[model samples]
Target: MLLRNVLLLLLCLVAATPRSWADDGYRLWLKYDKLPNAAERQAYAQGMQFVAGSGATPVLRAASAELQRGLSGLLGQPVPVVAAAGSRTGGVVLRVDAQANAGGQPLKPEGYRIVKEKNNLVITGRTDRAVLYGAFALLRQVQTRQPLVGLNLSSNPRINFRLLNHWDNPNGTVERGYAGSSIWQWYELPERLDPRYTDYARANASIGINGVVVNNVNASARYLSAEYIGKVAAVAGVLRPYGQRVYLSVMWAAPKVIGGLNTADPLDPAVKQWWTAKSDELYKAIPDFGGFLVKANSEGEPGPQDYGRNHADGANMLAQSLGRHEGVVMWRAFVYKANSNGDRFKEAYEEFQPLDGKFDPKVLVQVKNGPIDFQAREPFHPLFGAMPRTPLVLEVQLTQEYLGFATHLVYLAPLIKECLEADTYAKGSGSTVAKIVDGSLDKHELSAIAGVANIGSDRNWTGHPVGQANWYAFGRLAWDHTLSADVIAQEWTKMTLTTEPAAVRTLVNLLDQSRSIYVRYTVPLGLHHIMGESIHYGPQPWLAKAGRPDWTAVYYHKADSIGLGFDRTKGGSNALALYRPEVQQEWGNAQTCPLSYLLWFHHLPWTQRLSTGRTLWNELATRYYTGADSVLWMQSQWAAAKPALDPALYADVAARLQTQRKEALWWRDACVLYFQTFAKQPIPAPFAPPTRSLADVKQLVQLYQLK
Candidate 1:
């Protein structure tokens, strides 16, 4: 008893003593841990002795504060902020020069230039916001352990508006969010501001993201009311200092629901007047509010279609409502019918393609990267280069709604880059989705790109710690589409995980191959939309029933005794015709089509030979088996990286990788077994058949649904 009491006293003393846990990922890539290299730390500290910039401007103040904070943390010493660069031997200076040039190249409005001016490094740009970005760039260099001597760097955002579309509701639940509750904290906003809001802004500003839509597209009318407008204004106030603007996703029925109007029709003058008044009221509350993101006439959301009007009519009304406010309306083109007999892939193109030049100048038709929803691998949306007159906002989802949620480590930069680099051939061979999205091809002044955010109230922001890489990758790519996926992966690995070369290379290789690894295991060879119904968790290739025909998995794969794959060519849905003739020619013929997209455009027999020299059946089974096995490789690579990574972060990913391997096996077994029933073939030699029968897999699906 005396020994137990002594032990208890020791444990109590241990608990009372102060101790610091390893990184919980709350700081994200901006951890700013003290530099381990003594030489580099001394060099950076000498170069950043003090920060000189305008303290009057909010953005400049933010830049100066961030420079001081970052440099202090990195150098293990406090850095001073001074009023002027005046005679400082080695320091950082921030200047706003509209005609600033770096390496004889002109800087865009939001672009920044960092060059050595005398003994000090000068970060100059056209606007205060750009100066802030330049400051972050300098800190990124230090964080990534890049050489700081004779630094010369210039970067311009290819897209005019880089935004995050949050699908959070007022009640604090995030739709399709794998992380915890919504970050907005609607119940406490307006009266109490979370310090997290500032950190969120800081993270966004570091990556050149300038705007955020605070609500879901399936919006609630309550957000438009005066009570909620105050709440939004409070949130905007927190973000404004970091050069970020707040936007709203408005419910089309707000006038009827909140304004007590008889009709919510866009063409109706009362509805128009109500919107104008509301817009003006919003501007009054938050002077720099970004405009509305509308999901009209899609997915049972009340829209102008309810009043016999088109998408253009609805979008134009909202644009007019903005009036003198410096904002633009982004109308989503992710529309399809519940009871349509035609190909769902062709529906959005058919509905919006005809009204190409009809939209208002301030209207941007927000098109998903793919024709369908954010599938694992989709051909670039046909509407990208088709509508020359209408500016398009390319929307991609960062949330892994269908890509194994938070359990799988699927790096999405490659998936996003694939769509951006696709040749549309709209204006000949040079036309690409990137060109269309940046407004260079159409020569339009306004352009934007949005990523459906995966952020939440979780300590790590995204549910999976590595999921932070996707958010970082989206912002980096949105700023400069020319950056390679490997480069972004390496940069992120260094900033967020480690600076060791071998560890960085291993992490980069893992990230570079992760998306494809997921694609092969889950939905290989261009197969799309075969995930579980509603929840979209695991494989359900046999799903033939749902609320709507298009929602069913079988509606996409079309696997039968004769063949498997969706046919979008002339002999089938003819969706390929939606693209330019050049693109159609490239993807139209099954015999010459790339194997990656072979199943997307044609249905081929199981016995047919592929370009890879394997029968379709054999190739399918091989991909399933090999993809599942790749998870083990990912686990091993991650294990190799543990020594260089934070213990908490490393263990977090290792546990998730185990979950990924199990699910990958589930996907492989379920898909292989289900498809085997149609192929009527044995698992090829050198590969074993799944231990679970088709019925057993179906039972698994039911079990998931029960959860």
Candidate 2:
């Protein structure tokens, strides 16, 4: 009886251990370890018999290894690595050359070509790194179950740099990280390199992200020291195999703090020499070192401005250090003064536009997607195409600082897509933000797009399981800004989990509607940052005081008995003048403006009637209710599709959806109750009265100070 019980116990233990089919989301979209269907296994087996590629560049070699590992696991067969193409064996050929091979059209350095030959397929590129990217692309199609027959695709990156900026400190704590601790085990790095470094590289490579900023933009001078350089080199070495280069966010005062210089002025010859020497030393440690990222003269950080120099002076000085290294400097334009005299929204444009044509060719001005910080919703930044002569890189935040953090399932692709698709009209009618960013509008040679990373040391990478989708979506959009959010969501859903057509449809609809739903409940119809003061987690529409005037919630909502919303029209900030006349015309009028953006553009009276036939207060109340109500629908949809998913994973998301639903109602109740004081009106019929008094809500907000 003891022997029989022991055997049964062993079987139970084995069964309970997590499997690839279960909810351990460590695999992300590269879930090749999961068992595959018989037909897929056979097709992949026949198509990936062996891998052939060019000279052994680390990038190319890594690509070959990844293909073999992914193919062997998915198809349950060993895939041989070959040096050159041989008699067609229904395998793949990876070609890396300066010129196209086999009569194929030539590819750009960052471009790739994938063509299906009789029984074989050729993945070719103009360079070894390009071939690496092409390999990942080919594998992605297979992982998503796309038909491989008659494959003839040629692709290139629209942006020159697709990068992730990590706001992590040297102490291993992430500044705005909602996920656990920082991913970089900084204290043990350069010697105790973790295997997770390679895993990080693999995840990034699969999605076409090629660069990483290793520290916070609020930088510490220590990263520039010799010790940190060695540590950075170690991280770079792991990333090198995956075709990724590591960039550092430098403290502008590094010359004084690290190099023993008296002053760190951009125009100072000694300071310039110190930086040049530092750059040389960095390249020696890591040959493929991406250039520096700088945030100066903003929020008390030191910069060229401290020495009475402008942004161009600071950027140009750093650009000089990277001379002939094929490196580029990204200068952040998120500057605003400590004083309250000027409008905060116009600060970045005011600072950068005049410096146009003054920056070095290798220096790209990095602008946020919105004029303000990454609020749930705001007008597009005026700087997108305002400075035609400058090379600008659009910076977006994947971290949910103003949204609900890791708690809310906000699919940010639509938000990203909204900013990219907005018409800038810099050159003419068709000069959309996409064209401006992709370099087509101004013909700028250097273009880039970046997202502030939300990654951390959580077991699943991102804290929330679904937060992984935002990272995946950013890379897909970065690779090709024109890809629709719906298409990307569907592809990710199919590749990362069950490929049941019905379940895919449900997932796509959920993701497609998610961002707008979040906005509706949290800060609907152009309502900007009203989250709780410091942590920025939940709603605090009544918050009226902060150190700075613009930092308070009431400053943005501008709620009065007459109306709600920020007025940036002709009579107010006149920010509309920054856009083309057509844009202004569309947004300048409350009667004609889109309802989704009505509050963002106009401060209409509460009694004004909207197209929906509801008064402004009534409409606002309805939107908050409807938006929160959608969370229930999302929960139901996810539940209905649960049978097709891993039980553990399904239950995890199901619980999160429950939390989201509860919080959504909290946001609705709190915002409506608070705003009612200004509107001086009763709660509309059917919407319940406030569960707590206004003073009780204030006490509830005070409890959030622990964060």
Candidate 3:
């Protein structure tokens, strides 16, 4: 009785101490930070004993450690790990059944099931990796401030494969990575495995992401070399316990570059043998290798088309080599040619819409969210339901390549939801992109979704602290698309920042309004692909020096004395014909078109009147001004809730908002000033003119290029 009283006294002391907890973001949403409420902490402390599996495995050890760490921080009590549970009522139990895994749903290698019994909780799976996933799921519940008792959750990934495509190259530099250098140190990798690799796996596993393609999609022949395969396998071993399978991006010209064969053609017998042998070698090293991601015949990459074959022949040859290995090929459909004749937007639909059923069952054609690359805002791809016989995977970019690097905060769940909710009208009215991706629309078994990763070696994983929300948002939406953006933001805010109602409302509004703000200041009214050449970092409204006409910035924005925007209706490129007539009818007429996407499909005159009493030019200028003004509102919203935020994090985010305000002004001033020359109009009353001349803004761009 004396010992029990002393323990209760200790718990009371620990509950009163708040500064002892660490603030480092390495823990992410799995922080398991202390519960502020006294009643909540006492309830969680009731079931605090640790129970282990029968055998000691690497994955089981990890599950035990994570639970210990989480419960210690959350319950304000250090729960001891034990080998068995003996009538310990209200205590946490980790039971593993090697025999009980026989009959259940067909599990993904990393899938797990967690159930609550009369006095215990069972975290089990067909394999040890599943146990590890269960541990993370339980931690998520604690972090999200949900009741842990009576928890009976069994979650398997809806998509068969959820992977991250890194644009890292053989050299240390990442193609568009804004966080820092590539995480993979190739020169030291086969031997000196960084401890950071384990932390990376933990972060990914916590979010339920199961696979990673570690190299650039633009293929490099060196990755196929035997020495580099050893390096890749080392990374795979670290991720294995966390249930993540490693995939590779293969060079289509491996036969010519690495194998020393004359041709890498799919029809050639020797080329076929080379790829088979190479795949066999990879499987020998890493038995559970996910599969290959091919970028054949896109951009400047070589493919089977060089030898008069199509994507079907190329994807099938690779899929045949992985026979019964439990893997599949992700053939990217981001193809466009150098031809100056046809519309570039209509090319991918024309090319792959004809070869739907010819692909192997193991092959999935990965299409982007839009017909083009990751633009700010775009209509849903017309190909979502164009091919009923083949399986398709939706590829969304989490990296913020087009949304403003890592600095600007744009919660992407809404953007993804916008695309998923769009009705394809392929079979009927209810056929949405979400149904097509989840395998409910076309009735195909294979279905998956991918996000281009934004992770790096930063202590927080992503560079900007708020950028972590994008990564978190992607995984949450990937698991369940029906979840609302507001709900996710509220959950993440409660777990990651503060649970104060004022702070939660402020953060949610900032996220909900963020994407529209970016679109307004950057690419308002559906104008697309006008970012600066190659780097695509900033604005360039006057670029006209690219090889193809469509490749230039001037093509999409046909600005002169008369009008602006690309005309893709029946008279112009006719790209609208790709969608069903129901979709076409809504977007076909310029006057009745949705205001969010009006400029994307039609070239309207500056003097033409809009639905509002204002002229087209006045509306354009107003949107730009309003976009800049919204940043001020965001700043004020954040400031109003500052007392509810941690001082360190509050200051960090405050500093970033200042930068955002300046950049927003830069965009508004530079774009409006340059376009004013063509429109032949004043800056309009009440709105001030640009501080600098148009020549000065052009010079600023020139100086950025020099750097």
Best by the TM-score measure: 1
lDDT of 3: 0.81
Tens-digit lDDT track for model 3 on 104-123?
55545556677766667778
Q: Tell me the deviation in Å of residue 297 in model 3.
A: 1.5
Off by over 4 Å in 3: 1-24, 54-57, 95-114, 124-130
C-alpha displacement of 529 in model 2, angstroms? 1.3
TM-score of each: 0.97, 0.95, 0.93
As a whole number from 0 to 100, the lDDT of residue 352 in candidate 1 is 94
> What is candidate 1's lDDT per residue for 329-444, written digit by digit as tens?
99999999767777999888899999999999999999999988999999999899989999999999999998999999999999999999999998988899999999999898
The lDDT leader among the candidates is: 1
Q: Give the Å shift of residue 230 in candidate 2.
A: 0.4
Candidate 2 lowest-lDDT run of ten = 8-17
Compared with the true structure, what per-residue lDDT tens digits does model 2 show for residues 283-360? 999999999999999988999989999999999999998877879999999999987654688789888899989999
Question: Model 1 scores what on Cα lDDT?
Answer: 0.91
Q: List candidate 1 segments past 4 Å from native.
A: 1-20
Q: lDDT-based ranking, best first? A: 1, 2, 3
